[model samples]
Structure formats: structure tokens, C-alpha cells
Target: MLADELQHKIDFKTKPLGALGHLEYLAHQIGMVQNTVSPELSNPHMVVFAADHGIAASGVSAYPQEVTYQMVMNFLGGGAAINVFCRQHNIAIKIVDAGVNFDFPAGLELMDKKVRKSSRNILEEPAMTSEEYRQALENGKSVVSEIAKTGCNIMGFGEMGIGNTSASSLMMSRLFDLPIVSCIGRGTGLNDTQLLHKIRILSEAIEKYPHIETADEIAETFGGLEIVQMMGAMKEAYDQNMLIMVDGFIASIAVAAVWKKDPQILNNCIFCHVSDENAHQTLLELLGQKALLNLNLRLGEGTGCALAYPLIQSAVNFLNEMSSFEDAHVSNKE
Candidate 1:
């Protein structure tokens, strides 16, 4: 079998067995994902989906809702952290306006896949109508398809939306059968009073929709536009057999939703990092996944994905380029 072949090849590398630790597992995983002993990452891209959340009006986040579009502009202008990191790593970056409220001018160099101005306030009603949810999902799939046509076999998903952590927290609670308070976090640096207020507001929102039982129901009921769109992108990426690098809290929630529908997708996914967000680690544990890094990152711009890209490259590089014990004339441990 290919698994055994890959493991045997890895075990014979010129080093003590398992000395390379996680890197060996990563190489094996990449080999399995690509179904090749010699796998290569090609045309890697980072897609940042930006949108607005109505719950931002409820003060769930420290930043105002307008920051969503403002940050999108920052991304387009190459001023965001994601841009810096992607540029540093030579990975292509794409900006997506999933559902930000502002109407960007023509020729802004964005993917222009907006589903709506912004999702409805989850505190009062469903975050999006059924049709809007469908549109967001389709937009996500379409964007990924376009990227795949460019021969990009590996991609990471990042999100920018005010009050999105609230949506993520609610989805985590519903999908994992955890309490909303346990899922809630101090998004965008909420203070003690602000965090408590967010918890209260989310608790009430959960009570408002006591019947949202399924992942789709919970997502459509509470997911931000970018979050729902990310779910679609992840599913499409898995279909394309591409390596999927997932970013922090909001992105992970979308992943959890997609994983709930089809567990097989997990094999193609690499959780990039554990965010400082309170429940991110819990969410990872619930998904039976571990992140590649834990830099106390709270930034949600696919920064983790860009930061971890080299390590992924190292995994693939060593698998295909490193010398074997036989090649190096090193005696094997008996």
C-alpha cells in the first residue's frame, strides 16, 4: 500500500527513527494527500474573505463594523499583516469581499463575490436568508475553482469580519454540544465588562433559536457571510484534492461545519495555529486536530497560514529531497 511505502521511505531517512518528530508525520500526511512519495507544493495562495456581521452592532467586538471594509481596503493596498507575510513567503494573495457592507469602487482588484451587504443581526433573526446562504456557499466554491485552474494545489483560508467570533462561538456550541459561554471569547480584545456583555448577548441569541439543531441550520442561523462562504471554499478545496490550511477561530468554525457534513475532508486539512481566542483550542480538540503553531495569534487574516507555510514546504522538501540512509552510507540502527 502507498501508506506503508511512504512510511518505509520515511523511516529510512538518515536520522534516528522519529527524530524529526511532527515533520515526519507532516511529510507522510502530504504524501498521502497528494498520493505520491515525492510531493510538491505549487502555486500556493492565501484567500482572505471579508464580510460584516450585524451582531457587531450589539458590541460583541471591540472594533466597529466599518472596520471590515476598511481592513479590506488595507488588504488591497498591501498594508495588512497577511500581505506582508504572503509577500515575504512568495505566496499569491487574493482579497475577497464576501459580504462587507461598503460598496467598493470598480477596479479595486478584488474577487467581488459579495453575497449581501451584511448578514442579518443574529440577535434578532437568522444571520442570512436561505437564498443568501446558498449564494455565499456558491461564491466560495466558485472562487476556489478559479484558483485551482491556476494549478494551485495548496491554499489557506482567512476571514475578516466584525463580530464574527460571536458567530463562530455559537456555531461551535451548537455543533459540539457545548455551552455558549464556554465557546465565547474576547474577540478583538474585549475587556472584562465587554466580554461579559458579549457572553450575555450570545446566550440570549442562542435562546432565541432553540430549534437550530443541524450544522446547516446553526450556520445559516448564526454564521457571518465570510464564515458560510469559507465552508463552501473548504468543501470545494477538498474536492479538488488540494491541501487546505485553516486559520484561526472564525475559519475553524467554518471548517467544523464542513467537517460535520463530511468527515473525509479532515484528511486534506491542516489546522494552522491555535488562536488566543478562548475556545479555539477546545474547537481543535473537538475536531480531533492539532495546529502547526501556537504563537498566541489573535489576528484573523490568514497570518497563521502564511507564517506556517515554510514549515509545510519543509515537510514536502525533506520527503522528496533529503538523503536516505542507503544514499548517505549511514548504518541503520539494528
Candidate 2:
């Protein structure tokens, strides 16, 4: 089997057994993902999905909702952290206006996959209708398909939307059967009073819909436009057998939603890092995954993905470039 072959090849490298630790596993996983012993990362891209949440108006986030579009502009101008890291690592980056409230000028460089001005306030009603949810999923698939046509085989998911953490928290609570308070976090640095208010508001929102049992229902109830789109993109990437690098809390929730539907997709995903968000580590544990880094990152612009890209490259690099014990004429253990 290919798994056996990959493991044997990895184990024969000129080093103590398991000396390379997680990098060896990463190489094996990447080899499995690409169906090759000598796997190469090509045309790596980071897709940032930006949107607006109507629940942002309920004091869930520290930043105002306009920061969504503002950060998108910062991304376009090469001023965001994601841009800097992608530039440093030579990875291509694209921004998608999934459902931000503000409209950009014509001829903007980003992909215009907007489904609406913004999602409906989940505090009052579902964040999106079934039709809107489907559209967002289609938009996500479309964006990833375009990237794949360019021979990109590895990509990361990032998100930008005020109150998106709220959506993610709510989804986590529902999907994991955890309390809303446990899932809630101080998004964008909420103070004590603000955090308490956020917890109360999200708890009430959960009360409005107490029986969201399925992934689709949870998503439609609380998923942001970019979150749903990211879920779609993740599913599409798994279909194409591409390596998926998932970012922080919001991105992890997107993966969680996708995983709930199709459990097999987890094999293609490499969680980049655990964020400082309260439940991020818990979410990772529940998913039975570990992140590549933990830099106390709470910023959600695909920064973790970009920061961790080189390590992924290192994994592939050593697998392809390192000599075997026989090749290096190194003595093997008796």
C-alpha cells in the first residue's frame, strides 16, 4: 500500500527513528495527499474570505463592522499581516468579498463573490436562508476551482468579519453539544463587561433556536457568509486532493462544519495553529488534531497559515532531499 511505502521511505532516512518528530508525519501526510513519495508544494495560495455579520451590531466584537472592508482594503494595498507573510514566503494571496456590507469600486483586484450586503442578524433570525447558504458554498467552490486551474495544490483558509467569532462560537457550541458560554471568547480584545455582554447575547441567540441538530442547520443558523464559503472551499480542496492549511478559530470552525458533514476531509487538512481564542484548543482536541504552531495568535487574517508555510515546505523538502541510510553509507542499528 502507498501508506506503507511512504512510511518505509520516511523511516529509512539518515536519522534516528522518529528523530524528526512531527515533520516526518507531515511529510508522510503530504505524500499521501499528493499520492507521491516525492511531493512538491506548487503555487501555494492563501484565500481570505471577508464578510459582515449582522450580529456585529449586538456588541459581540470589539471592532466595528466596517473593519471588515477596511481590512480587505489593507489586504489589497499589501498592508495586512497575511500579505506580508505570503510575500515573504512567495505564496499567492487572494481576497474574496464573500458578504461584506460595503461595495468596492469597479475593477477592484479581489474576487467579487458577494452573496449579499451582509448576513441577517442571527439574534433575530437565521443568519442566511438555505438558498443563500447554497450560494455561498457555490461561490467558495468556484473560487477554489479557479485557483486549482492554475496548478495550485496547497491552500490555506482565512477569514475577516467582525462578530465572526460569535458565529464560530455558536456553531461550536451547537456542534459539540457544549455550552455557549464555554464556546464564547473575547474576540478582538473585549473587556470584562463586554465579554459578559457577549456571552449573554450569544446565549440568548442560542435559546432562540434550541434544536439545531445537523451541520447544515447549525451553519444556516449562525454561519457567516465567509465561514460557509470557507467550508465549501475546504470541501472542494479535499475533492481535488490538495493540502489544506487551516488558520485560527474562525477557520477551524469552518473546518468543523465541513468535517461534521464529511469526516474524511480531515485527512487533507493541516491545522496551522491554535489561537488565543478561549475555545480554540478545545476545538482542536475535539477534532483530534494538533496545530503546527501556537504563537498566541488571535488575529484571523491567515497569518498562521503564512507563518507556518515554511515548516510545511521543510517537511516536503527533507522527505524529497534527504539521503537514506544506505545512500549516505551510514550504519544502521543492529
Write down the RMSD of candidate 2 (Cα, Å).
0.7
What tens digits encode model 2's per-residue C-alpha lDDT throughout 102-132?
A: 9799887899999999999998999999999
Report the number of backbone clashes for model 2: 0
TM-score on alpha carbons, each prediction: 0.99, 0.99
Off by over 4 Å in 1: none
* Backbone Cα, N, C clashes tallied per candidate: 0, 0
User: Judged by lDDT, which candidate is best?
Assistant: 2
Global lDDT of model 2: 0.95
